[model samples]
Target: MNTAINSRIPVALTIAGSDSGGGAGIQADLRTFAFHCVHGTSAITCVTAQNTLGVRRVDAMPMEAVVAQIQAVVEDIGVQAAKTGMLLNQEIIFAVAQQVEALQINNLVVDPVMVSRTGAQLIDDDAVKTLCHTLIPKAVIITPNRYEAQILSGLQINSLEDMQAAAEIIHKTLRTKAVLVKGGGMQGDLRGVDIWFDGDKLEVLTTKQVETKNTHGTGCTLSAAIAANLAKGKDLWQAVQQAKEYVTTALTYALDIGEGQGPVGHFFPLWGLGTGDWELGKKQGSREQGAG
Candidate 1:
């Protein structure tokens, strides 16, 4: 084997919308990337006026602007891996798919942000169809929560078997290398389980669910962590497993900053475990959560 490598820092790109709330979308992606010690780049698709409560308004960037941002980032910076979240509409999705194809980006992670954990539709029907047709096939893996998986695979996910079936369908239909059907929205014991299928064996990755209302940008964080790990040369399964652990640890330090649902503590390493101050962090987190 030829062993030739340079000393360049790994870079991860995020193609997504801007969340003013700073809990989800591009903000969360960049934070997760930073936590992984990877360089993070971004191309904003839409700008949303949002908060912990809900989205107030959204202004999508023009197609040319979105494309230009991606082109600029890729031409000079050269992404090692990329993850996409919250492509606002059909046009944006099509544009992103075109850029990914044109640049021949191999390690692509697609987080299909079509629906919320509460079963609320976050994207339009046209965008969903475009994503299923164009973007997903180019991805190395697609991460879809239970709600999005149900919409994409046309299955009602009520159990682990249902999640496995949905992962199979998503893999076969979307032509992606792998599918991670997240079970966060599932009721009871299935809550923190996720089904992973790579057109071969299926693996159920499970974690103890942290009981917290401050799970605002969990999906974004997890997918971004995967992309960051991929950029750092981790294998697919290892990347996913490590990413899950990071998310769980972050949830263990979830912050209560806003009036509504708060965000997971992305800098837990600086404040909690890394500094040997988890007890103090937990106490502070509780006070902040109660204050909001």
Candidate 2:
């Protein structure tokens, strides 16, 4: 590795859960940050035993410990931007929000991790209020998948119009500054689209969805990648565009890593490119980088 290009490592923080299987959560966030050449730090709020199949169990981290981690990072190394995932309870949500407000952090991307792709409940039922009232206002941008967006906004989204309507409402009501509604669950033949509502403008972003099982951690990776780009000073839309490109490439090279579903080849870029390592698909998966 050449040290010449390694100037100041732009710092980004992820306040999310831990996935022992490494498909999603902090593990995936770290890999995505490294791919974009940003230094990553984390404040883990829950621990889980999971794989490509689904999350089997979750134990929320103690609020005190979570507080300690956030304090340590913001007070020491100082993050350029931050994002969050899977907050299990009300107390934890409030805990994270307080610290974020105190620090007045910028470029905060919130990935409301409510449910798993396998339909497992990752967030607690009782904490929805706390999440909206506290976390939403603190975030610079909120990235929610179709279901998660629906739940967070209390809107039934089945069409593009509905998604745009709900995104604007959520943005205004929550005062989140911006709401990015991801249409990965769009009906019938339409390419999956993600909409971003930044108070003034509504941008709908689309990418052809590949029919593959390697989509684990995509939401987390997208938000983290956006935060990483923002850490490097890209504006909101530019960050989202770059993040979308990264996910597209990652998904194009899906990894058959687990017994049940599978994870996207996080390091899939290095194989076809030759000089670098498709660190995940090559070192960790049977699939090749450009195989998709």
Candidate 3:
């Protein structure tokens, strides 16, 4: 809203699908980054006919075009951090992964978005191989909701124990830096716990559940917010914490827009009293843990 004052916001890149409903995918990433005063760059992998409730259809961009978008930005203005979501096909996945490597980008956040909340699968089963092999290994953080973690690691996740087990399986098998196995899918009375497994130790973050149906784009927002904090120089643990806190606050202040699940007000800090700068909790002379 105040473009003049925020002209030179720090840059973050998001490679994902286009959400026509503006509740998820590229739109949510951009809004989340802008909320943190980070300039957002996007490489739209596909276009989806989607709303708060569900996805009606999805049309993917060609591999050539997807590669071109990443090249067009990363090679030009450059980026401090990047996040990926909803890479529909294998071609686009390979292209984006190669570009991230070729561009030598760091602090990359990967949200393995396979299906929509409404049960429409966005990614092909074949693409899963390419995504796990090509992209997962290079990412600084991987945010996989319960279903996604199960899919990636081939582990049955029914509890926090299962989430922790799956996180290790993913990390050891893929060799990615850190994995955040989101506990949003955990069963039973103890649910709001999200597990972030660094290489050596596991960090458990829990919050009270906000009983709202307006939780669309939560995964995308969390991963993008982590990338934004990484761009702002927070290490992996701090960034993850910052992202979790932001998501909780956003969910608490949800606008309840749209007929189905609504979008979080990523601009909460701008319009309301948002939790601010948790990475300010960082101690002096801190460092990241081996690229996570």
**Considering every candidate listed, which one attains the maximal TM-score?**
1
Q: lDDT by residue for model 1 over 60-160, one digit each (tens)?
A: 99999999998887887788899999998999999999999988776899999899999999889999999999999999999999999999899998989
Flag regions of model 3 displaced more than 4 Å. Answer: 1-8, 116-121, 272-292
Query: What is the Å distance of residue 42 in model 2 from its true position?
Result: 0.8
Candidate 1 Cα deviation (angstroms), residue 194: 0.5
Higher-TM-score candidate of 1 and 2: 1
Give the per-residue lDDT digits (tens) of candidate 3, residues 1-292. 0112234566899999999988789999999998887889999999999887677998989889988898888776778899999998888888888888888888899998875533355578889889989999999989988888888789887777888898888888988999998876666654558887877988778876766667788999999999999988889999999889898877765656778878876765555235443332121102211111
TM-score of each: 0.93, 0.89, 0.87
1-292: candidate 2 lDDT, tens digit per residue: 0112234888888999999889888998999988988999899999998877766898989999999998888777788899998888999999998888887777889998876543456567778778888888888889888787778778888788889988988898889878888766566654458888998998888876666656777888889999999989899889998999888778777677768666665776557566555454444333433333
Sorted by lDDT (best first), the order is: 1, 3, 2
Q: What is the descending TM-score order?
A: 1, 2, 3
Off by over 4 Å in 2: 1-7, 118-120, 272-292
Local lDDT at 50 for model 2 = 81
**Local error of candidate 3 at residue 149 (angstroms):** 0.9
